[model samples]
Target: MNTNKKAMMSAPNTDQNILKEENNNRIIHKKTDTLVYALGGLGEIGKNMYCFEHENEILIVDAGVHFPEENLLGVDYVIPDFGYLVKNNHKRKILVITHGHEDHIGGIPFLLKSVDIEAIYAPRFAVALINKKLEERRMLRGVKIIEINEGSRIKMEHFTVGFFNTVHSIPDSLGLLITTPNGRVVETGDFKFDLTPVGTNADYQIMAYIGQIGVTLLMSDSTNSGVEDFSISEKKVANAILEITKKATGRLIVATFASNVHRVQQILESAVASGRKVIVFGRSMENVVQIGRKLGNIKIGEEHFITADQLSHTPANKVCIVCTGSQGEPLAALSRIASGTHRFIKLIPGDTVVFSSSPIPGNGQSVNQVVNKLFKAGANVLTKSILNNLHTTGHASQEEQKLMLQLIKPKYFMPVHGEYKMLVQHRDTAIETGVAPENIFTCANGDVLLMRDEKVYQSSMRIPADDIYVDGNDISGVSTAVLKDRKILSDNGLVSVIISIDSRESKILCKPVIVSRGFVFIKDSQSLLKEAELIVYNALKERMKTRTTFSEIKNTIRSTLEPFLYNKTHRNPIVIPVILNSKAAMLQMQQQRALKNSNHKAASE
Candidate 1:
């Protein structure tokens, strides 16, 4: 019977058998699950990471790092955690870069060290910038880099991916469309729909085509979705800058984001039109000019890139200084110029300093300090607030967000590149465009989203999104906890209290030892310390009667000491309690008490 069955199977036509096998393979592939995961930059605004999983293989998008908050002292940068994909090493195929922003590409060096990447696809300028970082890290080995342009496509096993041009402040920003066997997913990598962009606008036709083809998933930028208007263009800001230059009589200084090549071009144009030579200052500004000019994104006359020595000799009216440090970085050229510490150039009376950038959140205090320094240097200063429209955001606003949602019309929407509230706002915006409520996904760093046949599933496999604290070139995996501690220490000050107690009887042994830092000067705050020690002594004796364990005693001390300290000092200092098992000093005090008692008894007899 078995032999007859084998013969019957073999009797089937060869072409028919082959066709059946192929169909089986196709059906198995079509039924397979597909997933999208983010390594970073999903919930938070900075560290950008995403993964597409199909047929057991994964394609990664945009490995990046997050800049620290103001209180994150000593932190170098935060990289997305890749621990979840550590076991799936073989499935890792390609690292596709979206743009040249630091948050989008900064973690490449750190990430490349872990994953065995097959090839890296990025735009030309982005590749160049990443190469510089890779070289600096000394880990550029065994990696194949492919420099791509807009409208380029790559076909891989069970997938086809293409890059479409998107307008951002940086050149060659692109969006990605990943086509699975069943559907296509559109990802907008930090974009603004600037129709009047310097060189190219958002690819309207490509977006329309995606809408027509029907995107299975749409992951778009939600960084600026909270504001209810269109993002102002660089052209509009250029006009405002030109007007400022026309009115200023003294030396004109413009401080902007170094990567804002379009804004830099506008400054140069306004400078030449105002009969001044643009003298580029600051290391970052100079590097940007050199790179952009080399790449043909920026066109500048040889006379424009003048040295600081030439700037010193030129009359104030003939010089237009373009520099960095708009965020008030202490080491930036603008800070040096403001403080009159620059080697060749300094701000003087009649000079004008225009800050052509908005104060990013958490940077307001530093920016204000820099503005005060500039004013003290006798230079008139103009910031976004004083000269409204002088600076516009690179991210899209509410109207453009609506336009993007309408154009892409994705099956599943993931709002990314924003804080929690911002992500929520973007989600609501997507809903207004008629996307089903269940189809919307609001993700955070490390969370994974799985898409199968246009249905999405979420799992909390949060990647190891961490901050690497760096001083100079050294790197360490010091978490944000360290930063939080520093902030607390800075704001509330620190207080250490020491009190000796009898371990067996739970009795006070000595007066509390109090030390204060950043709280109050010892001499000035003597009375406060005295009263605090009294409270600690009283609390310790009272709690010692009931509290048995050291930790309980510490907690009791903390509870009592914190309130007393707060009441007396009007500041809450971090309280630390030190308890000793044996109090030899207390024995000494007991011996003195006995001697005094004996003397009194003898004198009375």
Candidate 2:
């Protein structure tokens, strides 16, 4: 039961030859089993990627990125490690995307950076957003995104995937019905039972047809599984937002997810109905809106929408601003405005700031910080928690999950797209729907589920997986030591000891000079600096005879200063010893002292 055994132990293949071997042997010997690998999005809330492998052919679904936690300092985003896929990419036949949400499609650019994906299959609306993102990353070359509809059937080497309509906050969402050798797997891509949805109601007719076809496994969303009731409809939220916009006398500002096309549509309609000219901010929001309009996914009159440049000239009472960063993302439009850093937009006394989206689980602190900043900026802020009708969840609740379970009638169920607790809750719900307890799997990232002969079994084998952190254009593992050092420097400040060593002998040239930054100011704390210098000088004196290594000197300096600095100032500043030369400087003072003694002795004789 060595679950930690890595997958694809063989060497990696070149991009030119990876798919050659798989594509050449298209003759399918349908095995009686299907392997499901959860690359990400098991215990975590974001980064949603999965793999379905059968007959040595892999079909990847939803390559996505995860948002960094508070502790992941300087990280722009996090993604799946892709180690297994990199080693075994020859098995990949095609990559399919579920939707356009960041959690579902944000990692495409990064994946394309390394892996050579031939084609990407997505719906029309998702394709529009994906094209814009790909163009931004300059990754549109050599890539093809096939636009799919509800009835489109994609026949791969190991699976035949069929699409069905689902109700979501974003328009043109789809549910996947993948036919494999083991049976059929129904993948729910973020849905809610919204009969009166803002865009269109869930396609119950298509879903019932799939149910009649009989499903083998149900991989469902568990985001709101902890809530035991149904979530409010998006249409209700639109009406509520409309009412708020009508009552506001000054500029009404709304912040939400940029990919929420239906929400954006509702806001636009509300703006038009309330006789307010809409101004869209944030690059992502602008890009999505532009692409959506071009693709005919978002419809609005030309006069109803204006750019940010026109905000200054437009009357404040007649303006409605829709922007990104309801989650308090650092560089998003709402954050810039809340911090009073936006070049054009500023909150007036009568301005109303409405957050139409609730804060994500890990984003409470940042959202609160933004709200507090908005309050300090003299704007009236309204949140869903306080107003109750401002925001509605796009995920299926416990009741909806239960309903899906009953409708699909899956013999085996595995909860997807949520935390561990949510997954467990969903598993229990599946049990309540009469699915056998042993047939339900509440798995974590990298846990594999194998369905064989219409029976499902959870495997102990886990492939090596690591969090791939993206900081700008560079992709690396979550640099723990670097983040820890950064935290220390930020919290306690920094202290550096500059030691000039001679190239001749192994000794210090002069008194070790100490420079402090962010710690106690040099001008104010000379005594502390002097004492620190003495400590280093004494340590150097002890190592004067031996050829001390640079790392040795740095370690000695840091280990010596850390506890003392903490004890003295109640702060543990980052300590660095700058060894000027790679080798210890030759001791010039010893030669000078020896010459002085020889001169004295000669004079005395």
Question: Largest lDDT belongs to which candidate?
Answer: 2
lDDT of each: 0.80, 0.83
Work out how many backbone clashes candidate 1 has.
4
Per-residue lDDT of model 1, residues 39-113, tens digit only? 777667788888887875778888887877766676767776666566678774788999888888888887776
lDDT tens digits, residues 184-267, model 2? 899988899987887757778778778888988899999998997888888788899999999998999999988888888889
What candidate 1 gets wrong by more than 4 Å, as runs, is 1-31, 385-388, 459-476, 484-605
RMSD of candidate 1 to the truth, in angstroms, is 11.4
Total backbone collisions for each predicted model: 4, 5
Clashing pairs in 2: 502-585, 502-586, 504-586, 505-586, 505-587
lDDT, candidate 1, at 371: 96
Model 2, position 397, has a per-residue lDDT of 89
